[model samples]
Target: MRNFEVNGINCVNCANSIKNALSDEFGEIVVDLEKNPRVVSLNIDDKDLQKFTDELDDLGFKLIREI
Candidate 1:
């Protein structure tokens, strides 16, 4: 699994949107706006990381840190 901190998420709708967007591309994605340090976590192969990050970048969201 990977943990990515997302900034500029302002509302629940945005959270849900991100969750849905990521879900379409990855499986076992768990987006939590309610977390202390709001994060988007997912279980995906390493080969897909760059593509997913690119997709997130295209959405205008910064992928802060990957853990």
Candidate 2:
């Protein structure tokens, strides 16, 4: 699984919104959000990383980190 950290995610609604947006592009993917660090962890393919980043950027969220 691949990992990514997204910024501008403030609440559960934001988490769900990201999940929904990712689903449209990636189908069934896993997203784990930790409020303390304000990070979003994703379990996805490496090739889809750019797509995911672009999609999030289009949706107004910025990716702060990736692994």
Candidate 3:
């Protein structure tokens, strides 16, 4: 799985929003609440990377960078 650091994620609900909104297209997303700023792990094609970031932004999450 590829991991990306993200902001605006604090609790389960925030994590769920990501899964609900992104899983179908991007595959399973694992959100690590234990980390400050949080990290979301998932498998995504490089071709879809831009779309993935766009979708996350639409859900109020900002993809800071890959970790």
- Residues 1-67, candidate 3: write the lDDT tens digits: 9999999998999999999988988888999999988999998889999999999999899999998
Residue 18 of model 2: what lDDT?
80
User: How good is model 1 by TM-score?
Assistant: 0.79
Q: Could you tell me how far off, in angstroms, the CA of residue 51 lies in candidate 3 after the best superposition?
A: 0.1
Give, for candidate 2, the lowest lDDT window spanning 10 residues.
28-37
Candidate 3 ranges beyond 4 A from true positions: none
TM-score of each: 0.79, 0.71, 0.96
Tell me the spans in candidate 2 whose CA falls farther than 4 Å from its real position: 28-37
Q: For candidate 2, lDDT tens digit of each residue in 2-31?
A: 556677777788778888877766765555
* Cα TM-score of candidate 3: 0.96
Q: Which window of 10 residues has the lowest lDDT sum in candidate 1?
A: 28-37
- Clashing residue pairs found in predicted model 2: none
lDDT of each: 0.77, 0.71, 0.93
lDDT of 2: 0.71
All models, RMSD in angstroms: 1.7, 2.2, 0.6
Q: Across residues 1-67, which tens digit of lDDT does each residue of candidate 1 receive?
A: 6788877676788777777787877876677778645688888787998888888788767777875
